[model samples]
Target: MNQDFVNNLYDIKGKVAIVTGATGALGKAAAWGFAYAGAKVMLTARTQSKLEALYDEMKAQGLECAYQIGDPIIESDVDHVVAATVKEFGGVDILLCAAGMNNPKPILEQPTEEWEAIMDANIKGTWLYCKKVGQVLKEQARGGKVILVSSTRGKLGMKNYTAYSPSKAAIDLMAKSLACEWGEYGINVNAIGPTVFRSDLTEWMFTDDTARTKFLTRIPIGRLGEPEDYVGVCNFLASSASNFITGTTIYVDGGYLAG
Candidate 1:
């Protein structure tokens, strides 16, 4: 393999990226990775303190990055973020929709309020980001990338995850729908479906040895996902390496779906 050519295929130098839900484990990891790859990454989340912390971390590493305040469901906030990013970094080349939530409760125990919360955070929020940022990408007319963070539960349902399962399942179509509409604009929309990853979100599930064991047993790779497990894929998806790829969900599971 020609090393230089291979590197060029994945190069993200001078690109601009916006990562929502960037304070979360996967989002933060992805933001850092993109910044490290020489892209100016803009991080967005509800918590300014967390965003600042991540900004400081990037600065210390001499990577190009910044953070902005945003709520996925709020159109004004999404507009603000896109405007702010364009003002600072020129335009968006990659949009990573990593903001999502899940409250695993059986259908009988799942209240309407919980279901709404899940939809608001995972579905509505993601679409807002995609729609707003997608417009920016389209105007640029330079082709762009959108990576939505999905989950294995979206593909294969599980008990006690009523709202979450359906919410993520929505992302599958959302990505495809956006891809079809935006393909002519040269914008690629795709998603990542990770399984049983250990993050702040999954901490409680892993705390119980029995529960953790049961989850791990499902992965043929015999391991749970770490934060690092997501970076390479996010980086690839955000870079030119995946230029021809769109409207597909890449499973980052440890062979969980295979089984």
Candidate 2:
């Protein structure tokens, strides 16, 4: 094969991507990554202010991207966002489900409300979006890509991370099931299992000396993950580069899981 042909495998130019948690740090990073890769992007989040800010920045950079307020767990909200994307960007060729939450507390200390919140945002939210978008992709019959955000907690048992861990674990399995079910339609589904990263939720781990050191000890890289760490994986999954890959979780953890 020619070298340019191989390089073009990773190209996502003109693709359309919908990022569910576009306002949050992780989602924002993924949105920018896709936009910068020459794809038109549609962003959704419960908060509109930050989403608008990101849209402005991307617009100023001459990238095609738009934002709308949406609650990923709401059925109507999912449908509305999908319609909005097709209306504004033509059609959805890729989806990055980054909308999620975590409430760190011991199992006994975790309230029923907190458990529900975690499950709703991390599991139900992702599922709702996947289901709606899956419908569109199936109808289009053009095939597509879906990348769900999971975390290291999904694979490990840790203190104060009970609700979060289980929710993420669910996301990974859901992605797998979707991958198998959607394979005939050419839709590739995968999950990104991130380790401790520097987002608002992870500020404590990076700022507190003791906590930082503790996490660093577990990571062979002796450092924490930054939001940018997700960009490459986001681009790869959204592009043709990973067309044959599906139903697996890629841990971008600086070797934290290995150690």
The lDDT of each candidate is 0.90, 0.91
Candidate 2: where is the Cα deviation over 4 Å?
none
Error of 1 at 219 (Å): 0.8
User: Which portions of model 1 show Cα errors greater than 4 Å?
Assistant: 1-5, 205-207
lDDT, model 2:
0.91
lDDT of 1 at 151: 91
Minimal lDDT window, size 10, model 2: 198-207
| Residue-level lDDT tens digits of model 1 in 83-168 | 99999999999999999888888889888998899999999999999888888888888999999999998998788988988888
What does candidate 2's lDDT look like per residue over 164-253, in tens digits? 898999988998999999999999999999988888877987779998987788899888888899999999999888999999999999
Residue pairs that clash (backbone atoms under 3 angstroms), model 1: none
TM-score of each: 0.96, 0.97
